[model samples]
Target: MTAARTEQAPGTRAPDAPENDVVLRLEDLVVEFPAGGGQTVHAVSGISLEVRRGETLGLVGESGCGKSTTGRAIMQLPRPTGGAVVFEGRDITKLSAAELRETRPKLQMIFQDPISSLNPRRRIPDIVGDPLVVWGRRDERAKVVPEVLTAVGLDPEQVADRRPHQFSGGQCQRVSIARALVLEPEVLICDEPVSALDVSVQAQILNLLEDMKARYGLTLVFIAHDLGVVRNISDRVAVMYLGKICELGETEELFDDPVHPYTRLLVSSIPSMETVTGADIEKADRGRGEMPSPVNPPSGCRFRTRCPLATERCAAEVPEMREVRPGRFAACHYPMLEPVGAGAAVEGA
Candidate 1:
């Protein structure tokens, strides 16, 4: 959304991207699970995308929609069964132990749970400094830990000696971030970074990430299920359903004019702003039904089972990604983006 120039739908170049800024590119990425019955769950179906240097790309979808799996595949934390994860022009899917170790300094992950991600046995300083130590910066870690701690809104002097249980959830997440960032990674894959925190704490952490992005020139792969949060942070957003990308565009464009039926439903599903909102616990689950199981997702367009606009064709054929306009992509046999000045609905959407 950073004033990026438009090419065909799903533009190849970014708006306001610096000459040397583009960082991570995920091309034809597929993540699958092999089961005993010769049944494979294609968790992430051949999705291609690019994350520019200093840009935040959001991957939003339902819980079982492979958002987290995509992040895991990028980090190769859980071995990816197929597809390529390219970082700075290198395909990491084929790297060996030593090669992965060399690459680790530039790629890092901030996990979803703050409390669980940190080890209860480790003190704050040791936890934050672990990345530095692993990267052979032990001597310099002394100077770096305090700086990193302070950067993440933590007090180095008072909390340095405490274990994970000593601090609150928000503080633990900050510690986790400090740990991931201490080594100065170029690309950080945040797997639902704010999903586990209290809303206030979530805001604090989000602000920290924004600041860190500016200071460190970080390329962020932010994964989450919330639309408002994605709108606030991402330059580009890709909406997924049942393991495949349903829509992709700059944040403002996608939200302002969603081109896919599934996307419109997602936008419509955002908690209506003026209503006496449901209790915080139930708000996110209010309008949506249980997400369909991925093990045997609906055929053709996996979302057809839940799609209000689904037709016979939707259940029988996989729609191709079509360029609906300047810099937007939608996978739909009947791309239902509301035409400019026309009815506020796209075909079958």
Candidate 2:
């Protein structure tokens, strides 16, 4: 999953330098769906971010925030409605099918549910080896399948013969991990890969992902609704609201110094933040409302309705993701970071 230049390049890809360190870049990306009855659903809108070589960039938001669509767009599973997906140096959005076929081997995605994603009728080998079959690399598939199965901690001989239904949720997830690793891809788009599993099983899958990342030199765009899960695994975190990123920064910096009001609320939702020492404490209650339809998002800042700091300016103009710290970015007109153990000071008032 390491997007570490699957092929050698001339320069270093320092994270956040989307043009340089970027293994995958989504620029002003937008995807709209025809919802029928003369309505258009904006699944994603003007979203931009980068996955650096050998780093995990987490995209976190409530469900239906277009995180999954962003992953699908990267794979070009369904044609994107608009915008560009640049992988390596070439823009995959513009590549023809023939070109994309060659690119698919280096980029792959792991689904949230393993049972649905893996064919129930197909045995493990066939299911895990399907990518190779499609691309005419049968030899490599056979050679890598058993090895990856064992690498993900499965008994290759026993499990290889079983159908996906034969395994538990955890084992199936491991198999999905094996399938992803077998390709030895440069980038792995994980769309809530562990969300469906039990809490105990979740840890094993997360550990397996971390191990695989190191072993394969992988880069990742990890998407999830669970902020705690994201903080454990991501190097950088991006907070999305109504199809656009409201904040992004080094995981530690953003968690401790969250500036955006939406981000502050999300942090409060994670119980782990309270138990874990050194994590900033947000004693204030988070605002509540189901996210609005992306079909017709609000004008200016989409999060204005729920943001406590919202002002006439916030609703009248779109705020850019301004650099709040050297590597941290937040989109609020009034940022809300607090000093640790400083009696819960309110900021940007």
Position 200, candidate 1: lDDT? 89
Total backbone clashes of candidate 2, pairs 3 or more residues apart or in separate chains: 7
Model 1 residue 47 lDDT score: 76
All candidates' TM-scores? 0.88, 0.89
lDDT of 1: 0.79
Highest-scoring model, TM-score: 2
Per-residue lDDT tens digits for candidate 2, residues 184-282, read 899999999999999999999999999999999999889999998999999999998888888888898877767677887787667863542222333
> What overall lDDT, based on C-alpha atoms, would model 2 receive against the true structure?
0.80
Writing each residue's lDDT as its tens digit, candidate 1 over 109-159 gives 999998999989989999899877776789988799999999888889999
Candidate 1 ranges with C-alpha deviation above 4 Å: 1-20, 36-38, 274-289, 339-349
Off by over 4 Å in 2: 1-19, 273-286, 337-349
Task: TM-score for candidate 2, please give it.
Answer: 0.89
